[model samples]
Target: MRTTVPPQEKLSLNVLPSEVWRWSAASIAQQIRLGSISCVEVLQAFHRRIDVVNPRLNAIVHEDREQSIGAARQLDGLHRQDSHARGILRGVPVTIKLNVDMAGEATTNGVPAYSRRVAPADSAVVTNLRCAEAVINGRTNVPPFSFRWFTEGPLYGRTLNPWSADITSGGSSGGASVSVATGMCAIAHGTDIAGSIRYPAYVNGVVGLRTTSGRIPAYHPTTAQRFYGLQSMSAQGPLARSVEDARLGLLAMLGADTRDSTWVNAILEHEDDAEPVRVALVDEIPNVVVSDEIKKALQQAAASLVEAGYVVERAQPPAIDQCVEIWQSIAMTESRFGMIAAVEETGDASIMRSVHNMAACAPSVDLGGYIKAIALRDELRRKWNEFLRAYPILLMPTSCHMPQPWGADLGTVDEMRELVAIQSPLIAVAALGLPGIHVPTGMSNGLPVGVQLVAESFRELRLLCTASVIEREAEAGSALNYTAS
Candidate 1:
């Protein structure tokens, strides 16, 4: 229920740095509830930050400046009425990905033809954020249909990396990652079907959580049909500067909604007192090529986990290669029917070229082949499940190599295939509908590199707890403070 606002007008306040835009969502909410700072002041700080840095990055494309001010004022009024009333994300500025629905806003998904396709109602995640009193300052950009690993489109233009303009900002949630990394917002809402959230978080040097399927209620009112892999494999999650902030955002987003019956009512954390679980570290993925820097990143993360009291074993997850193939088959088959057709009808040359090349990597499956793939998928999920029962968490590289240069994905079919191979760590977890966390360890060759932590479904708490240990040891802010040349 919406809290009643006080009769008092919006309070006049002065913005303060070091405690304003730089604070995490958890800290912002706590400070606002404690009356240490007015909600208006916090909002103004982010508004000023966005004004200064957004033009250079182009991360946040659609902003309702007046609406945001009004919302912040409303939140301040509510706080005045009941200082005790504090949602987990109260007054925290958040940037929503353009692909998700926000009432009366365009769910463009980077297609110019559908720019007028305004959402009549908020998606489940948006409603949850509003209920948690998050101020929606702006919307982040995405690739056409959010399909590419590089964030650029004909509609909103390309989102440049804060570290290097030559490299990608990482899509389809590239804009979301950049927003958090550059202090555009405390937390950014993003989706991950096949590494969209984690990859961007890796490249952008932030913490991203790819919650298990159904962990967060998600539904786009503008979407016409329900595809096979969309709900089962994809998830709405948060990308933030720190693991604690991401955890808070995930807490705010967890719940069941009638609109998305597929959502599970799972507890965020178990009450049992268990020791830190064993971790499987995979530095060298079989048959996939990776740079020495990537290998060092894996070792660094594993070493941190060991120091934090986790039993770090050097082992690979089962069926890594097969799971990647399953992702290709499922995505390719589903795309042929819906996503591919729509892209062909409305997509620009860049997206069309990337999509076509991706298709070349995986042939369209027939009905029988599709059924077999589903059966194979269940078997693979079973393997991971049983394996996870033994090793509760698996730590691996987010990508085999560093972030690709701009327009790398829009290359020859062979190049796309190589890209897919390097991304097996992300693709495999996606296919099994598991939870993965992308935590940046350090940088290599002037770019960020990180590790992916995977856990069983409904075990996000386990992943976060372990990631926090590594985050603290790694001193997470070095990359965030790096100034691009």
Candidate 2:
């Protein structure tokens, strides 16, 4: 709860505007490098903003003000010496999700019992961020074990949505999105297995990227066990107010890491610059009921893409519902092996209820069924790969509707199933390990709504480019600039 601004030794006496906190990560780093702004000034501005905004939102659960200031001072020293800092994110203020390891901090994952589980070394993502000289401002919150669509834990309490307190902030990356939305940080590290990053960004009126599996290496040294479903579905990404910043973060976090054997060094951009990007606009899906606001947002995004010269067609990807089913089957099936037992031992009442309800929704299968599910998952990935080959980008609703009220998923087992059904677009694409971006369109009835732009693995550059155009349209329509404090 230390909210005091950093000592203003190298800072300007004139009060900076509230909008200073909203500068994109790229712009912040550029100014810092150009000697126009000191890293200390940028970090202090964010810490001041965090004090003003995070108290109400509870988006940042943990902070190390001294550590952040020291890091910024070091970057300033490098600048004084006429030596550049690290990579593209040098001197940029950023937040890390609490589930990941940052040296000397606990990887709490919102569990009270493991509050003492301090990490001895940085996780792969943290290592990458440090290498890029991205100053860590604070650690964001998550649900216990990150096991729900809403972010509230017995240890950390709840992360309120900046837009509406009644609605969900969207877990397990809820705090990350809220932090970005409120300008707590320029970039937020987020990981998504099923809609964790995208859903929160959708509700918070920000941008979040769920990169393809293995695009960003992730490893928690304290909890480093191999989980099949997690290995296949989970991806490390970034949440920001702009898609360009998200793209910058994704690039900085990429490349192979020995810690994660699955990490790939594949080229991230389009192979052929002259190739035309084909976008599939999916406004409706069979058996999915989307709100009119959601439909309008999708149509608006489609029109934006069309204007941007992307060949937009009204079409749906193959087996949308089947992909969701596979996600539930594999994710729940793999969790049963060990995660369920851990939750039973240490989870709070809310998380325990959610785990049970989610378990009830996707019953555990025998070995034969598990094997078939894996094989079926492979088949679905093949089909999606083929489909994506035809349509390089798919523009669809991020969620079937706006974010639900807090604790909606904790209702009856049937209610949990309904919630999952609505999140089919998020879960399905995750099942196939594709990269998806949540691009916010505008507000609806004081709530945020947006569309999802998905691309084949390693085609994140294309998705970001398409989202930039949609972002331009959204900015033109909305009176309140999201980046403005």
Candidate 3:
């Protein structure tokens, strides 16, 4: 078996303090557990990095440096009292998205009216992270109602892409992606209903995993109820620089909570069979104009998997166009019930325009039509599951085209329809409740480009393993290499 030393293992006692911020979460936790580095030192190193980089990117909108430092001190004391006191992610610095509940902090969701709506308690994901002994260093930004792909809003302003100003940072988890890419934190929490997590990671050149729905329990204490579309499709997952770090974050975040009725306790890993796995490569979609750059990236990823001893073949799954339409029909219909009204009332002009454009594209349906769409989703899932039985993995573009310029989402209804088509890859996976991840291939046109890997529900282990292979073969350099121009 091939092995490599953790990044921290290569550092000497006199190494530059700034370099500590670049270490992976696995490396940081391992070093902290070994007692060679103190939690205070790790937290302070990240604090300095945030101070220097966050002003330019606006990734982390809320921070409490003193509180994080105090927490680190407490963790250090516990580690001194007992050697086994370290959790899997002990002393690792993490950021939570602003839309999720963090006790005593506002679940702003990028609305000015809800700026004072402080959460009475932490959400399930937040509780799990705390239990794992990870330090919550800050909160990331989101679009208004977290409804747009661009991370600018009236509440916290815009989060700039570290690579280019003209390109979007990729929201509604844009802040999360930027924070991880720029070394503000080792791991960041994000949510995905459509392409929020994967899209941001693709554009920013980081790893974002959208776990199976209900894999990680989600609940916000401040909100009374969530629309069915949001409840069924939204997923909580981690964004990190490496697949190993994302796996560690996912493990720590998984736990049963009574608050979420949909939460399930499923086996995370399965024993590997003797036969090699097969990968289904999707380079193009019917009637969709996939960019040459993205198709080339997918072809490169397929080649990497083949080299890694996996069987790779060109194939397309069932009814991708139908999946996209069903997702829009159900989600848009449910949003009209209440979410649209709220957005219009509280959302800023950008989000409002984006939402209006999206609604315009969605097919208006009656209750019976909505129910039929729900039933059709099950049929699609059944077909997809049958397809996966033959090919355990699916490789495709994270988005049909490369990352677009900012304000693309705020374009006309016709433009928004085109944007939705481009995002079909992300939407189909989410709508069917499958596991998907974004792994960067390399740079093109001076911007990051990547491919998406997906597996059946509760098969996140497979996705992560495959992504690790692609990530290793590609060797796409760190997002930190790019200056925030």
Candidate 4:
């Protein structure tokens, strides 16, 4: 419901910070509703922090402060009108990824090519956040087309990790992760094609969740047909400093968003929470090399879960080695048919770079192999389902290494190819269409590393529930460059 409130007017108030920037969305909302803090007050505090730290972080780029304050004021007015029940999100300021549409704002996806193009309507994800009563305060930075784990595009420049400017803030959700890590937003909206959300959260020392393919509806009016694997491999999700915040954000985002036709009504559940469920920890996923430091971080995380009364086992799943091939075919076909065509049509260098990568992979893939790859996808999903039936959560390295330097991983097409190769596990796992969480556990060479947790379809509650166990026990965080005041 639109309100008649003016953008300039606000309920003047101030609230002191309860503690560090580690506040969760649930806790912040509770505090706002309890009148311990006003919506405007909390919103302003975050804004101030962003202004102070974002120069170095470059997490949040474009934002509508007036609109946000106005929304907060409207919520305040509503709360006064009816204090019986607070809204879904009473007073939480959030950052939206630039790749997604927001009404009357440009959805650039960090392309220099479309920097001036503005979206005519809000995306399903954005609409859902508004419905949940979250204040849309800022638009985060994303790589060109939300493609890579390092956040940099000719349009919005670069989004450096708050942990260290030297290392990358994982993309395409890299900006969102940086925003949350630096306290710019309580929760950030992000999308994943391969390891976009998970990578950023892994690098920024935060938590990121990738909803199942249908679990969160993704739509863009620009294209009539979405590439097959790009259609199934991609998802929109939340990035936060804590698992509880991830839970709250995912709950608000899950549902049938009419914008996407494939969305299903898959409700979340917690199966037999009375008895602790099994968790599988995998440090090896075939091709990727898990660094010794990264291995230590995963082991430490596993030990913490064991201490928390959950049965933690060191094991690899059935057919994990074949995942990369299947994933490569699925991803390559989407690019070969879609992205390659777009690049050839435009002949733009940036788009051409994307095409070149696809063309390089095309020759290696067989026509029949692609078809069989599609068939095998079903079997892979089945294996994950059966595995989750026994072990509700699977823990593994979010990536094999700590956050890479901002431009270290993607300078050349070869380098970009290498990144995809290294992160094959994440891409393959995401294709199964299950909910997964990437929780920052430790750092190496002063950069953050994380452990990933995967759960059954629409079973975000279980993923978050299991994640909470490791989050508290392993108090590890990403590398942060704390400036002296």
Candidate 4 residues lying further than 4 Å off, grouped into runs, are 1-22, 341-355, 358-363, 366-368, 411-418, 478-481
Model 1: per-residue Cα lDDT over 1-485, one tens digit each: 22111112232224334637777776778779879888889899988888778888899999998999899999999999999856778899999999889999889998998889999999999999898899998999999999889999999899998888899999899999999998889999999988999999998889999999989998779877467776788888999988878887887887668888778887776642124778888787766777898888888888888886889998878988888888888888888878888888874889999999998998568989888988899999998999998888898888888998998888899999888888888888888889999998887777788889999998887788888878877844443353333
Q: Could you give candidate 4's per-residue lDDT for residues 1-485 as a string of tens digits?
A: 22111112222224433542445677668766777667888888888877778887788889888989999999888878876434566688889988888887877777655666777787787788888888888999987667666777667677776666677777778888888877888889988877888988887788899988878877755435576666777788998777767877876676567778777777565445324578888888675688787788778878888887888888787676576667667776667665556445544455456446634643356678777888898888888788888887788877776667655552576776666656766776777766778977765666666788887787776677667777777766533334423
Q: TM-score winner among the candidates?
A: 3
All candidates' TM-scores? 0.94, 0.93, 0.96, 0.89
- Model 3 lDDT per residue over 1-485, tens place: 11221122444445534478888888888778878788899999989888888888999999988889999999999999985754789999999999999989899998998989999999999999999999999999999888788999998899999888889999899999999998999999999999899999999999999999989999889987777766788898999999889988898898889998888898887765223499999988855799999988888888888887999998899999899899999999998987789888874688889999999998889999999999999999999999999888999889999898999978899999889899999999989988899999888978888999988899887788888888877856567764544
Candidate 1: list runs displaced more than 4 Å: 1-19, 272-274, 477-485
Clash count for candidate 4 is 3
Q: Rank the candidates by lDDT, best first.
A: 3, 1, 2, 4
Decoy 3 TM-score against native: 0.96
Per-model clash counts, in order, read 0, 0, 0, 3
Give each prediction's root-mean-square deviation over alpha carbons.
Answer: 4.8, 5.5, 2.5, 5.6
lDDT score, residue 191, model 3?
94
Q: Which scores greater on TM-score, model 1 or model 4?
A: 1
Better of 2 and 3 by lDDT: 3
lDDT of each: 0.85, 0.83, 0.88, 0.73
Per-residue accuracy of model 2 over 442-485 as CA lDDT, tens digit each: 87887878899998888777777777788878942221243225
